[model samples]
Structure formats: structure tokens, C-alpha cells
Target chain A: MTDAPKAAPATNSRAGTKKELSEHFKTYKHVWVFIECEYGVIHPVSLELLGEARKLADKRGVSLAGVILGSDANLIAAAATVCFEHGADLVYTVTDPTLAHYRNEAFTKGMTDVVNTYKPEILLLGATTLGRDLAGSVATTLLTGLTADSTALAIDDEGSLAATRPTFGGSLLCTIMTLNYRPQMATVRPRVFGMPPREPGRRGEIIAHPLNLAEDDIVTKVLQFVADRDSNQSQLAYADIVVAGGLGLRSAENFELVKALASVLGAEYGGSRPLVQKGWITADRQIGQTGKTIRPKLYIAAGISGAIQHRVGVEGADTIVAINTDPNAQIFEFAHLGIVADAIKLLPALTEAFRKRLSVNRLAS
Target chain B: MHIVVCLKQVPDSAQIRVHPVTNTIMRQGVPTIINPYDLFALEEAMRLRDLIGGEVTVLTMGPPMAEDSLRKALTFGADRAVLLTDRFFAGSDTLATSFALASALTKIGQEFGVPSIVFTGKQTIDGDTAQVGPGIAKRLGLNQLTYVARIVELDRDANKIIVERRAEGGVQVLETRLPVLITMLEGVNEIRRGSLESAYRAASAKIVTWNAAAAGITDLTKCGLKGSPTIVKKVFAPTPRAEKAHQVPTDGLAPEALADAVIAEIFSRQPSVESDLVRFSAGQ
Candidate 1:
């Protein structure tokens, strides 16, 4: 089917839209976050978003609402409770069987329908795979603006959502404002904002809505879901200690040096984004803006130049040690400790040394 | 079946240096290459073309210089290249970009055949938004399959397409129909090197150039910054941390001794790490 021709502006200029658009959107109030729920589990990024959304909602003197779409009633209710405990003032839920799986069709329709009904001034979603999939379509359906992978979000002085994100491969930061769009949308990566403390027994108003979507209408069918097995575990995000390699590792074989250190220290091993693109590591083990955002207690980098993209993902570490031959490597700027040496040679020695220290400590104990 | 793959010319980020004084990106001397992610999409499109009896058309929306990227795609055996360039498209955000590109695709469909599938990278390194693909899909009323790791099955006669999409903690094997927009995941496939014949063909191939109006974009206000709802209010570099890392002198020491000194320093700074390391070893 061909797209129907879109209606053009009557005034025929950019200046003609803002005043009319803002007035048109005057009724759009409150900040709403789409609580990402699939199967029976609610994504942690949804809770984190509610925390950030609460701040934006409070800044605008409006209610914080969390929109959850799921097939199960108990799961939706449970997620709504968690949302309320975190920060949401109310919850909007659309329960339907088609919503059980994250199909772009069902979720987008469910989210957009609720959004159109409630008229939220600002909407937020986690920048997870599912969130990105739904946000792109929803924003397009609503003909609004969406800033993806925002590192920081705030309410501008004029009461607009100012979303700041890394651009130009994370070398630069830009603040984007949807000046004329109601329900200004943006997606934030996991752990970009701190999770708020949950208040036990906190209750909120729950508003229920019908999905009005049938299984037949959805084009994409989920044939199966192969959950990541233990053998393929790459829990880099939650690891207490993380050891990562970079392009400086030279070859995939050299990357084993990084894995050796991590194995010795009982740490999770990962590499930079390029290593993933270069097939040295899986996408899950990539440490950068586009990959996993890690918050480790101790992070050790070998031969990583630590670009801004990689820096944002690891800045939350309690302690970071950077090992590279170049003293001027960007990783040194934020790292707690710096060692100027070739990771290839130093990694094996470091692994041996760490193993000996651990064994010695074990003997003493 | 006609397939259109979107390519972008992005600065080689490794060579991108920020001006120390102004903290602005130094564009000079930095080479431009086809977005690395787009290569996967182009390769996937070409593979489909090779499997089925069809042609792969590479499309891009950028400055006139973007023709270089289009030429590069042609070297990969694309049947045609279309460069959608216009002064009005400058400073366009994702929304505006999708508008222009979707319009161009429409024109392409009218001129060529309707594309069975439209392919794009999961995200551009420069924009990194990954929104434009879905935006185009929505505008064109096409089903979108994003973050697709593999095209498991394709039956053109049945108009069925099944793909493995990488989702949270799992792989969702999804089945959809034709007339879809797909954003191919990186590292799934390697881009093939161009043959000598393909290289010669690319060097002489004429890139189809279209202005906004020529691409049937009548909305002047919707072509560029004017059409973009999101405005970039500020551009700045991330602030460097106040405290630089404490240097561990590796002057004359071997790797082993240096490792020992590093361990001591870490333990001295954070006494808790020593206890934690012991616990880790004990658990192992």
C-alpha cells in the first residue's frame, strides 16, 4: 500500500508552526514513562526511568504516570506497584494477550493509543532493544520527536524536555529539545540515571485500558524465545570486577590476555565496541555507549584508549585501572590508577601476580 | 524483488580529534567513510539479491560529497546508487531526515519497482539514534524488523520473512511479511571485498542525484531544520574529571614487579578490595 500524501502547512514556513503547535499541545500534561514489561518481568530500566520521570514530573508540577502493557493482570499489577513505589503517581495498563510478547505492532499500538488517550506532555522509554523498537514507531506514528540514548534529561526553563545525548560516536554531547512536539519523547540507556529508593507499601492509582489489538492484526509472530543460557553468560553490567580489552590488543588472540586476567580475578571480561564489530567479542560483551553500561566495583582496562563512548559506560565504577603504553590515553583521565605498559606483556604477568596474591590470602585465611 | 539499502557517510571516528581550545570537533583532515554499520546492511541486501533474481540499489541522503560513499557501495556490486542531496535538508533531525528519505524512497519506487525490503544499519555512529529506520518504515507503512541478527527464512512467493532478532536476554525468532524495513545487527556478517570488475564498474557508474523537490518533497518547511521538531540547543564536550589517575611508575621494573607494585597500591588505596579478592578466590 502506498502512503497517503501528508498534509502540508498552510502558512508554508517554519515560523508558523510553533505558536500554533504549543497552543495545540497545551492540554498535554504530566510526564509518563512506558514501563517495559515482557513475559512476567519488568525491565529495571523502566524503574530507573520512573525515577528520572518523577523529577521531570515534579519540575512541571504534574503527576508521574507509568504505562505498562502486558498480557497477565497479576504481572501488570505487580509492575504497577513497583512503579508506584519507585516514583510514579499513577499507572496506566493495557492488558491483552497479544501484548505478551514485544511485537513492534502490538506494543506501539497499545502505547500510542494510551498516550493519545491520556495526553502526556513528556514520554520516556528505556533505550533497550525492545524500547528502541517501540519508541521509533510510536514517535513516528504520533509524528513527534524522539531523542534516543540520552545520557542526561531535564526540563528546560520554558517547560520543554531537554534531552542531552552523546553524538558523533560519543565524542561530543548535544542537548536536543522537541520545541513543537507534545509528548516529547526520549529513550535513556540503562544505568544512565541512578535508581530511586523504593518506598514499601507505596500505592498509586491504576487506570486500565483495552489494547483493542488482535493476534491476527500483528504481522510479526514470535515463533520462539531462546533465553540466553548459562554457558553464554556475559553479565558484564552487574559484575563486581570487569576487565576489558581494546583495539590496542591488536588481534583476537591478544584479547585472550584480557580474558586471562578476568579469569584469574574472577571478574567479567569484555571489550570495546570495535572489538565487537571486529568479531573479537560478542555484542553483549561490548563496553561502550551502544553496548552494555557497566557499573563495577573495580574496572581494569588493558590497552583501551577510553573514548567518550566507553567512558560513559564505565564512569560509575568505584575504581578503574587503565593499562596502556600511551600515557596520554583518554582512559587515564578518569581511571583511578594508570600503568603505562603493553597490555600483552603486562596482562600475563598481572594475571600471574594476582593469582599468587589471591592464593597467599587464601593460605593466610 | 527490488531492495534498497541506506548508507551514510560518517567521519572515521578514530581520526576525529576535538579542538583543545574550543572543544569542538576538528573536521579537517579526518577522512570520511561509509558508516561501518551500513556495510552490514548493504552486504545483507546484496546477499538477498544474489540469492533471488533482483538488484540492490544503494541510497544515501547527505551532501554532494556523499557520492563517494555511494561509489563505495557500488563497488560492492549494487546495481544503482541514489544520492538525495539538497541545501534544505541540512541540519535535519531524525524526523526531518526520515521525511526526506521516505520521500526519496517513494520516488525510487515510482521510478524503479516497489522495494520488497528496505535495509539499514542498526544505528549510525554519527547519529547513533537508530530511529530513522523505524521512522521511514512508519512513513512508508512497512513492517519493521530491527536488530535482526539473521534472516532465518525468506520465501518471496509466500511473501514471508522470518528473522532472529536480538532482544533483552534472549533471541526472538520472529516471522513477518514482505514490504518490511530491517536494521541489520553488526558483526552478523562480514562485508566482502570488491572484485576488479566491480571496482571498474563502480568507478564509471553514474550516481542518481535528486534534490528535495526532485524527490517529490513539496513541503519546504519539512525538509530541514524547519521540519525537525527537536532542536539542538547546545553542543559541548564532556567535562574531564578533575583528578587524573595516579601514575604507577613502570620506569625500570619488569612486568612482574610492576604487577606487584600495582597490587600493593590498589590494596593501600582501597583496603576492602583485598578482602573482596580473597572472598572471590575462596568462592572459586
Candidate 2:
């Protein structure tokens, strides 16, 4: 196999001979969202997309549909019901025994089958592990386009999907339009969109689809799934408050002081991208454009310079408190409260004060 | 077995300075550097090739200047380097970029031995999309694994690779067959320096530059903006918040007193937050 001389590109995998759009592609209507469900619980990002899809649906004057794929019929039904509660007008679901765990081949086949049968003009998915894997495969199978990690989505005057998101490492925002592609696909991060209110009694039509896949046909297997629910695993997305450290902290050992403040405040602790790259913290604890996006009520930063990459994740906080020695650090520009002091010195003082005050309040109550 | 690593050349984003007055990028003397994340991928590919008997070829889709990055990969112990470039491929989004790269890889596979494994960075620092790796895998129909923390086992005889894939909340142990694509996570392993002999070879090696047509791109429309569906309508900066930071009066104050002052300031602003904190801490 190694002896062949390298030459021209080999042709395979949905390489279209023609360049123009199909008239059928123009007929594609409605907003469809892929409902990402794992272990009987639907991923929250899917519900968030339904909320966003609802707005796009309203703008386009079309129905909103949620597409769910799984092995268990009952689980798929439950997901469809939840999708309805989250403002889906209808649901197209595919159920099969081979679809239990997220295998790319099965999910792509199921999604492509549903999409080809009932076309959608706009499609959204969560930028989760499963969603990214499935979206890329489905988009390739369909020979369409997909924009990843969009921060904003809207229907423009020409009836195209306008997806806006931070680009070039979050230094600037760019609005992208998938004008020529049918089923304009994009993935949104978890916290970028709102969680739609669930109408408890709301119901929608559930159209069942079939996935004729067998176990032997799948190439990959999920050997085992171990929950990484360790105490240190980050919970920044749902935290009430977050304490983050950045390159300004200087040393890996100094990052612990950030943790001390988080503990005293009962908040989640995280670090910027450089801290993670320096092996000071796990990637899971990294907060930035490339990492987790947080919307905590209060985000306390100690020694962070607040680069635009890090700013994108923490800007959603209600009150940003930045503590840095540099008076003119970028963080102070956006921080609701700024403290010009050494984080090493100020963290201990803040930790002690918070621990004492909170304990006192606890005892009094 | 053969391995192909995809890399990119990005501006050294760390050194870019904003002018104090105009807030415009200070591009003077800002050097082009290979994206840091791709180094991890290159290193992982080299390590795998070293462990088993195979060759590692580096690939990139960029302008002619990007040939420098491909040569750098050769200096880092790649067996060969290929640069896929064309004027028609300019301003291509992830979709067009992946299409061009995938065509080049198919060409690479036909020229060399079919690659058993393909590797890429988790995402480029500039694009930050992380879509190309999966896109290539899907187009090639390889078992795609993104955000791989570690390569646990590679049984060549069995033609299987097991990896620890990083997900949203946990690490998933996946066992997949050969001809798989992996997007290496950062900081997992440090990149190694090129040997003296390899560095010398890299200095003299002629990089194979291919245009879109030579790469067997059949559709010209899909080669650039025509193939790309995502059109950039506008670029803008986020508006700064109306209100600025309200610094607590801590000038000349002791540490303990400063903490107290900040606490008082916060409590005065939000009474509900204090009560919620107390209730949460007490687990009520």
C-alpha cells in the first residue's frame, strides 16, 4: 500500500458533480433541532436549541420540529414530549435497538433519513461531544454546510440563516450566512441561548421513523462508560458564582489561592486557557472562548488579564469582580468591581473574611 | 501503517498589541507561528509512528507562505510534507477548507500508502471551530474521535485503537477500528524537538505544493466562496457596558479592613445574594 505514487485527489463521499442547488432544496421548510439524549436524560443544550429554534420558526412563519434518535422507544417518546414542552411544534423521531449509544454511523443514517424525508430549512444542534460528531457526519452525508459554535442565530430578509459568533479566537464577532445551503446547520454552545419555559400540558405530533441498523454494521463500540463525577470536575455553567485565575497568577502553586476563595464563597473555581496549557489545571476547568462558557451570577477574577478569549465566557456574569495588581488591566474595563491589589495578598484576606462572615450568618440563622 | 497530521500557521496572537489611542492591531513585527495546538497533534503522530513501524506526513491547506509550516513539521520528524494551496481557495470557511483538505488527503493516500490514522489539533486557535477534523473524518468515512486526551492502546494486529476521549463531563473509553481520525487535545504530551539529521533534511526537503485541480477537486464552485455556504456578513466588536467598575475604597487600608469594605459594598448592592449564599451554605 505504501508503494503507490502520490498524484491527484481520490473521489469519494458525497462529492457532488454539479454545483447548482436543487429546486427541491428550495422547497425545504421549517426549523429542525436535533434532540441530543444520553442515558435516558436529554442534554440541556438540546432544550436550549428548541428555545432558539422557536424564535427562528416564528420569524420564518413555519413549524418547529425536534428530531430525536435512540434505541428505546419510550426514551425517544419522552424526549419528544419534552421537546414539545420546550416549544417544538412537532417531532420526528427514529428508534432502534442499534441506536442505544451514540454511534456516528447509526445516528448519521437516522438523521439523514429523517432530513431527506422531511426537509428543514434551518437546523440547530448543541455543540456537545455527541452533537459535534453527529453534525459533521450528517452534514457530510447530506453534502451541505455547517457552521460551528454560533452565539447568535436569526432569519435574514432573504430567508437565509444568519449565524453570528465570536471568531478569530474571540477577538471579534462575525455574522455568517448559509445562504446557498439547505438545512443550514449550526451548533450552539450550552449557555449561549435561553432555556425555554416548559408548558407542562403542551403536546405535539410525534412521527416515528425507522433506523434499519444492526449491531454488526457498526464499526465502533462503547466498551464502558465511567462517570467522571469527581468532586473536582468543574460545574461552572450552573454555578451561582465562579472564581477564575489567569496568566497573571504567575505560578501553578498560586492557583490554589483562587480555589481557596472559591471554597470560602461556595463558588466554582476555574482558570483561563494559558493556565490549562501550563498544566496547572485540567481542560475541564478552563473558561474561555475555546473552553466552557459560564453565566454565573457573580464572577470573581484574581490576577486575570481578561483577554477577549476569556472575556467571552465570563461576560454573561451579572457582576464581574476583578482583582489584579495592574490598574489598567483589560479586566478592569469590563469589571463591575475592580480592586487594584496583589491577588496573592488580597485572596487570603477575602477568603478569611468570607469564611467568617458566612459561618456567622449560618449560626445566626 | 501511515499517519497524516493536519497543521496550520497562525499569527502569534499573544504578542499582538492594541494601540493605546486607536485600539487597532499593532501588526509590526508580529511573526507567524504554527498554531500551538497543532504541535500536540504533530508530536502525537510522531510518537505513534515511532512506536510502530510507519511514516508520518504533515498536511496543510493555506497560501504559499504556509509551506513554511509544512517544512517545520518535517523538522519535527515528519517523513514528508504537503501544502495544498490555490487562489481559488482563499477566504474558504470550514466547509470549503475541509473539502479542499479532504481532496488533498485522498490524493496523499493514493500517492503514499493508505493512512491508517489521521490526526489534527482539537481546534485551531484562530478559527476555534474544531469542525475540520470531524469534517474530514466524515467525508472520508473514518471513525472520528474528537478531544482525545490519550491513546491508550493500538493493537496493530487486531487493527483496533482504544482511546480516552474527553467529553462534556467525563472521559469516554472508545474502541474503534483502524483508518480512524483523532483530534488531539492540548497539553496531553509535550512536542519534541527535531533531531539534527531531521532538521537538516527539513532544510533541504522540497514541499509538494498542489493546487485545487491537482488535488483532484472536481467541483470548482465548492473550492472557495462558491462552495462555502457561510458568508461573513459583518465583523464588529462588542460594545462595552455602560457602567464601569466601582472600586471599593481600599487605598492605604489594611488587608482585613479592605476585605470588610468590599464585603460591605457587595451586601449594600444585593441583599438577595447574601441571603441566598447563607441558605446555600447551610444546605437549606
Candidate 3:
């Protein structure tokens, strides 16, 4: 509206809800990871968190504990065993029929109740949809701090949980700290950390808790759970080698060059977010902050102007090879190898070369 | 029925640039637009209001200049626009920001009929935290449904809402009551362009501006930095790796020759990739 604004009362007053930092938070101890278990399967990110939590717990001279909420006792026990093998020194279980599915009300209440009863200095969760849903509600209910999509976590000299994440649209990085909040909370995306080596038959202490919530009290009801039939095709996140193209390919038809290269190398193929939006690639194949976070052994990016969003997703790759005609493309800063050439031309050449090399080896074999 | 859609005016991240030497965000010529994601939320709310008899009030908490975004929302057929602005809100993190917005929403409910549903984009591009929607829901004690892809059913008489939520590997059909908070996933619906008559209406629409006090926020500490639990201790450019990409000279080199050279470089750097490939090829 270009019309004059109807301003509030002239008094420049500052008044809102006040939540004081608790003084007894010093008593908070140990590092805890929320073991995200749904449909009797544990999310890999939960185990990855346990791996990193083990290091942070060790640094603080505290035990690494995992809090698992579920309806079935057998599932909970099995998940606890997996947590122990992954790195958890202790497991906190809350078994309630209401806690079976990831309804925000029950899970938030269960998670907050555990934190309030047994105060943990740090609480970690996966940045998956369910984890984010519960973490935000629980953190707000507890009046605590929570950093989302943290790329790194460490214990500072003063023992605060320092969570680092991309900020300002991923153009810059900032390190955030919950200086005075109990259960300094953070949510990390999957594949940001390495999976810890599993120890078979590892045992951990189990502390059972009750989720005092009743089914009637929970407002939201789950009608049905429909698993994606083609979920297996979206293996971009777990692929060992990824070859992706970008907008610079000129047209959707040219994207086939990327697939040809990937086919020859026996690798996965993906593209930048623009390609997905342009309908050149499916949503699952989009790689970036909003898309899948990938940590492949080898990543080849063609014609992609590595924006901040794309950088965060592929930064985890061990060795990145960039092919861009623009000499100053941002991907070169992070790529291990660079070729300043047109991807459309170079991709087919690379595919032919790889195919020939492999075929020659086939003949020898 | 009453609907409230939370909007944010953010620097077009596409135009935001970093200083080459100092690494400071250069906000000089960067234009501000309604956060791209919030458009889906706005469009969805408008659609619901058109389907059911209701008013859609677009709300935002930012500097006074954020009214531009509110006006933009009005042009897109929002019935009303409310701006929650104050200097105290500067440097507010997601938690603090949510507290302020939640307080404002409570006041809006008191003034205009209590909202049946609140809407926000899945996340803001500037902060990208995605905590505010759930934070507001928890503060207001509303059911929270995030990353909602579709609203399957909405029965005003029954006060029931069914939605398809995007989960880890599937779509979850969830049923909840009225007065819930939703963060709509992107690409759910495209925003519509206003008609000429709607443009004229928006041009004269008076934006209701509220300060912290007017929003019925009773505590000063929680309105701004003092309320935030997390502190940004450092902001810096990502440190460049120890070494940059070793450039393969492409001058006058044929595509095949360049490809061979690049392959040589890859094997030299990561020998395992070559070995892994060879083993896989032999197995095939």
C-alpha cells in the first residue's frame, strides 16, 4: 500500500515475554543425541550424530547418551543396541504407544521431559523433517537455544557447544554458541559426519522414562504412511561418485552429456537446483542446501556456477573436479581439479575416453 | 475463518554479493523482495480464503521499510497487512524473532478474529533456520505441521484439516484440528498476479503498523537480543582450502586430449578411484 501507514501509539515502548537464563544450568551434564527411529528403522543421521557426540562427550569427560522414543519395546531395545554399537555409552528410552509415530505433540513432550529430568549439556538431532519438527517445539517449550543445519560442532575452551553453520544465504559462515542455555540444542543434516565404526555386542546402560502424554491429548492424528515407491532411485545422497551438470549446459537436451559421462564411469548423476526448477532434472537429483547434502568420494561438476547453496551440499566431497568455461567460476575455489572448457564438449570427450579406457582394459582381462 | 501468513522481506540472495577483499556483505544495490519461499505460503492462504469465507492477513516483523513486502502481499489479494517493527528487534535470532512475531499474532487475534490457521514458508532464505513457524506454534499452543506439500481437506464446520506432509522418504497424511500452524513447502502453488482493480485497492490500502508495546508484548528483554539464547561469536568467509584446483591448460587442446589430461590428474591425486573403476570394470 502506497498510502500512509497507520502507526502504533507514539510511545516507543519495549515489552515482550521475558525468559531468563537458568542459573542451575551449570548442573547440566553429558552429551545426548536424539535417536530418530521411525517405522522401526533408525535414521542413519542419528548414528552419525552418536559418532560425533562421542567425540564431544569425550572432550567434556562425560558419557555419550542417546534418547530413543518409540511405541514398541522390541524396536526401542534394538535401536538402543544399535546406538551402543555406534558410540553411545548410555541409552534413554521412553516407551509409550503415543510415541510410536512422530506426532509432534508426543515426541516433543517426551523429548522435553527427558531433558528436564536428566539435564544434558548438549542435545543433537538430525535435521530431517521429523527431527526439525520435534526439535523446534521442544527447544521452544524448554526456552533453550537451537542451531539448525549445523555443519560442524565442537567443544570450546569454556566448554560451550560451538555449532557452526552457513549464514547470510550461505555466502558466509558463522559460529553460534548457546552460552547459558541448558541442553544446548543443534540439528545437523545427514552425511555431514562420518559413520562411526560399529562394535558388535556392545552394551550400554539403559534408563527408561515415561512419556506422560495420552493419545487423547495429542491433537494431530496420523491417517496413513505412504512410502515413496521410487525412493531407491534417489541414491544421490549415498552415491560414491556423482557427476552433475548445471544451467550452463544451455538446454535440457544437453544434460544427457552429463548422464553419458556418469554412465561410463558407473557413477550417479545429478544437477544444480536451477536444473531441477527448470524441469531438466527431478527433485531428488538436485544437489544443494535445500536439496540433498552429498559426501561422495569423487564429484564432477560441469558448467555449474558454484553458488553458496550448491557449495554447502558438495563441500563434503573428497575430490571435486570442475569443468566450466568461466575462468573465475566459484566452483574452482573448492574444486580439486579444474578445466576451463565448455562442458558440452568436454563431457562427451570424457565419456568416450573413459569408455575406451575401460573397454581396452576389458580386452586385456 | 481467519488466516495469517507470515512474510519476510529479505535481500534477494541472488543479488547479495561479498566484498572481494574484505568479505563483507555488499548490501549497496541488492534489492529486497518477499522471501521467495513465502510466496507459496501466501498463495495457499489466498486460495483457502477464496474457497472458504475468510480474511487473509499478511504479517511480518522487520524494519518499518518491510511494509513494502506487506503492500506487495496486499496487491496479491491479501485482505489486510500488519507490520510489526521496532529498533529493539535488531539482531534477533530465530528464537527472539519468533517471540516477537508470536506476541504480535496474539494481538492480531484480539483485534481481528482469532486466526483459524497460521502460514509461513518452509524457511526464510536469509536465515534459513525454519524454527520460527514451529516456535510460533508452540508459543500459541497450536498444532504444528511443517513441510506440508498439500492440504488434502479442510472442513470449516468440523474444524478439521488434513494435509500431505513431506517426510524423510515418504508422504505422511496427517489430520489435525483448526487453529494450526503450517509451513508450506516450496513449489506447492505459484503466486498469482493481481488484476487492475486489485492493484488500485492495494495502492490505497493502509498498513496497520505496530510496535512492541502495541503488539501487547509485556516484557522488554524478550523482544530483542537479550532474549536470544544463541550468540553469533564469529562471522567470516569460509577459509579457502590450503591449495586451489590445479588448472589443466585448455589452450588449443582438443576435447579428447583435455579429457585424457584430466583423467591423468585425477588418478595422480586419487589413485583409489582408478583402482575402484578398474575392479568394477573387470567384474562387469
Candidate 4:
């Protein structure tokens, strides 16, 4: 599908006019979360973002809204209802065939248009593939500020959005501000925010906007949507318990120790980005800024030096236990519990211990 | 089918050290090299150019000293080199960085035929954001392909390309139309050394230099700090843990004894570890 329309005169008043800037900023109200959906399924990160947005909305004393863009009317309506149950006061729905698959051109155009038409002071998005792709483009188009992979979000004393994210490979945390920009934008990594209790039967106002752009004007074509093979998919983000290895594991062969522990815990397995760089593991098993974000109940990190990039990806774990020979490793700084030992040796021990404890518990039950 | 590979000069992160007293990275005198990941992308571009009998151009956006990395790209078989340098571009994060690069790419596209394929390393080790590639793809309207492990197939005549994309849990085999931007994953291919002739050419090749104005960027507001979305308010070192490693003494002990002692200390400190080992052994 292609979308063709004469480029609408950019309604973004903040682009050039100086006299109207103050009025435009004051007129903007409410906090909006862009619900990212793919293949007709709403991503969990979208819900996580809505939960975060609700908090921001509460703090700002403004209504929280969820914006859904897709072709399926029913799906958009359902997502809007879910958003309300999760804490949104209102939901804006934009449905069109062109909006079905996420083509950067159409999706960005659609979402940015909605943002410009109905101004929101704060806009939040999940740091998923689709969200990241769309956020960068939309921010650039609107000439607005956007912070990516933020771990924390709050309104500063000056009433500006303060986005805090780990930087310099997770060695430190830096708070960024999009001052003098309308609709302050930020994308938070999945699992970083706690899931809000869903109020089932809760509902909110649904406002539908017509998609004006025709399919022909869109330059990029979606030849086909190839869903990832089920067998090859890594469910690391959703694992209840996870065991990940790092360079401290010493070699690729040592990664088996990580897998061994993961198997015992019935958890997913992964490693730091360096392990993938070292060919010790595949890219899919990478857990860091550029990799998968995990929020397991318990996370065991073996021989990992927790760089900021890797730290952002795994900081959401309810409990983090680090096993590294270097007691000075960065991973220990944030870990709930730590063992200063070689992962190669300690991993097998931990795996065996967990196996025995679980078995004994099973027998007792 | 001229190809352009954009590479960055980054500090060797493995050798990077934080000064104990200053707590600042000891970047001075640390040899800067072409970003390791970029080498894989450069090699892939060279391979494509070799098979198609075309030229590969290398471009970089950095300080004047970054010419070294561009020359290095030339030695890897890039036929043309361009260095975009200016004080105005300093302190430029990925957003401003991409603006300069996109300008340079547009200029190159004007001089040479528009590149069919633009290559960049999966990400710079320093930033580790992996957003620049996608940013460039968005600006240029090229099909974006990040974390490409292998080029599964290519059809030059049909202008179609298929690649194995690295996703969260597995590889995604995807087919896309060109011209596309491909960010090559590390370990996919080993870089080739420059031959004697290539080395000489690289050393002598005149690298085209451009500034913001020279590259046709008229919007001063969208060039550097003003254009960037995210701003770094501060940079500090991570706080160290309160406790250091508790060591196990093994003075005058045999190999087995030392192992046993270490194991004993571990179990004593973390008693659950002992039972875990016993259970693991039983399972096996």
C-alpha cells in the first residue's frame, strides 16, 4: 500500500514563529503514549509505556492518552480499551490499511500529524524496534527533542521533561532535557517500568482520526512481513529467570555453563554484547543496549562487567545475582547479591544447587 | 554501482582506562583506530564492489586527525575518500553527526552516481546506541537493515537484496529492495589487508574536505547542537560497590586442597552454592 498526499503545510508552529512560541507551549496539554503494534498484536512494551505515562500524567495533573495507529478498527478499539484499563483517560485511534504494517514513512507521518493536531506536552514510546525506528524519524520531522532508552522519566522543577538514561556504556547515568521544545519525547526500554494493575471493565473516550495519505505517495514498500520463525525466537525478554554469561566466562565453550544453569532454572539464556563480539554467542543471545531487554524474576550474570549499555538492558530484573572473578566488576555495583568467583566453576555449582533445591521442593510439595 | 562506506575513528575501548585520581578516561595517547565493527561493514562493501567491478568510496565525519581512518578505509580498497571536518561539528552527537554524514553522502551522490548500497558498522563502540544507522536510513529514505550477519543472496539486475538479520532471539531472513543501508554485525567477515599498490594510493589519495556550508547545509539551526534532540547534562563514573572481593587463602596447599578450600569458602559465603553443585552432579 502506498500513501499519496500533497505535503500538508507543516502545522508545527514551533518551527519558526517566535511571538507565538509561548502560547503554543501553554496550549499543549496532556501526556500521550504511542502504543506500538506490529502484525496486529499490541507490543507489551506499549503497555509498559502507558504505565509510565500514567505516572507522568498524574504528576503533571493532566489527562493521560494512548494513540493507536493501524488498519484494524477492532484491534485499535481493543487496544484503546486496554489503555484505559491500564490508566489512560482517553485514547486516539487512527486506522487505515497503510497503517497496517509499520512503514517508517506512513507511521511517522500518521503519528506526527496526530501529535501536531492534538498537542500533548509529553510523549512517551517504548524502545522496541518499531518504536525506535519511528521515534527518531518523528522527532526529526517535528524538530523536537527525543531521549532514547531512558530508565527514568519525570517532570523537572522547571516543568520540562527530564529523561534519565545510562550513558557511556552504562558506566554512568545522565539526565537529558529537551528544553525549548514542544511535546518533550522519550523512549523507555521495556520492563524498566512496573506493570500497572489492569482494571478490567474500565473504559475511556475513543477518538478516531481519518488517515488522509494515500498508499501511492509512500516511497518505501513493504514487500512482505516475515514473522520470525517460532523455533528461532528468543523469549529472553519474558523469561521469569535468566542466566547470562560474559567475557569472564573465558571462552565460547564456557557459555555452555550459562545454558546449563538456565536449563535448570527453566529460564532463557543470553550474554553481554562482548560475548557476541567474541563469537562466544550469537547476536540473538546478546543482552545489552543494542540487544534484548530482560526483566526476569531472578537474573544470574556470570563474569559480566556491567557496562552502562548492558546494565540498561538488564537493570529491570527483580533480583540480580552476579558471579565474577573480579569482585570489582561493575555488575556487582547494582546486583542484589554477588559472588566473587569464577563463573566457569561457580556456574555449574549454582546450576546444580538450583536443580537440587527445586527437586527437593517438588518432592516436599 | 559505486558504494560508500562511512567509518568512524574511535578509541580502542578494550585498552581504554579510567585514571584513578582523575576518574577521567585516559584518552590521550590511546591509539585511535577504525571502529572494529565498521571494518566488517567495510569489508562487505569491498567484497560487493569487487564482484560487481565498481569502486568503493570511504567517508568519515570527525576531527582532522580522523583522516587516518579514512586512509585506512582506502587501503582496504575504497577508491575515493572524503573527510568532513570543521570546528562547528565538534561536540556533535549522533543526530548532528548523521546530519553532516547525510550532507556528505548527498554531495558524493551528486559527484558520483548515487550509491546503490551504503555501509556502516553496526554501531560505534563509544556510543553503543546503534541509532545512527537507523537515523541515516530515515533521512536518506533507504531501506534500513541493522545487525546483518550475512548477505544471503543478491540480484544486481533486479536490484533486490536478501540478508540474515540478527534479531533479539534468532536470525530473520529478510528480502528488501535497494538502495539500502546495511549495518554489518561483528564476526561476520574478516577484514582484508591493503595490498602494496592500494596502500600507496591510500597514502597519496586526496580526501575531499567539506564544512557545513560547503556540504549544502543552510539551516544553521539544524546543523549542530541546535539540531540534536538529546543533550548530555553530565558525565560521571559509576559508584563502586561498598564491599570488595573477599579472598580465600590457599597458602602451601595442594591443587585439590586449594580447590576444596576455595569451594569451601564459596559455600560458606553462599551456602546455597554447595547444594546447587551437589544437585548438578546428581543430575549428570
State the lDDT of candidate 1 residue by residue for B117-196, as single tens digits: 99999988777888999999999989999999999999988999999998988999999999999999988888989888
- Ten contiguous residues with the weakest lDDT in model 3 chain A: A1-10
lDDT rank, highest first?
Answer: 3, 1, 2, 4
Give model 2 RMSD, 1 decimal: 5.4
For model 2, residues A101-165, the per-residue Cα lDDT tens digits are 77777888999999998999988999887788778778777777787788878887767787877
TM-score of every model versus the real structure? 0.94, 0.93, 0.94, 0.85
DockQ of each: 0.49, 0.39, 0.48, 0.24
Clash list (residue pairs), candidate 1: none
The 10 consecutive residues of candidate 4 chain A with the worst lDDT sum are A1-10
Expressed as tens digits, the lDDT of each residue in B1-284 for candidate 3 is 89999999988877778788876677777789998889999999999999987899999998888999999999999999999998787767777888999999999999998999999999877777789999999999999999999999999889999999988889999999988999999888889998777789889999999998899988979866677777666666787778888899998999999999999898888889988888878888
Winning model by DockQ: 1
After superposing candidate 3, which stretches have Cα over 4 Å from the reference? A1-22, A232-234, A276-279, A359-365, B275-284
Identify the superior model by DockQ, candidate 2 or candidate 3: 3
> Per-residue lDDT tens digits of candidate 2, residues B56-101?
9999988798888888889889999999989888767677778888
Ranking by DockQ: 1, 3, 2, 4
Tell me how candidate 1 scores on lDDT: 0.87
Off by over 4 Å in 4: A1-22, A230-234, A360-365, B19-23, B141-178, B184-188, B238-284
Query: Native contacts recovered by candidate 2, as a share?
Result: 0.58
Interface RMSD of each: 6.9, 8.5, 7.4, 10.4
Q: Which ten-residue region of model 1 chain B has the weakest summed lDDT?
A: B226-235
DockQ agreement of candidate 3 with the native complex: 0.48
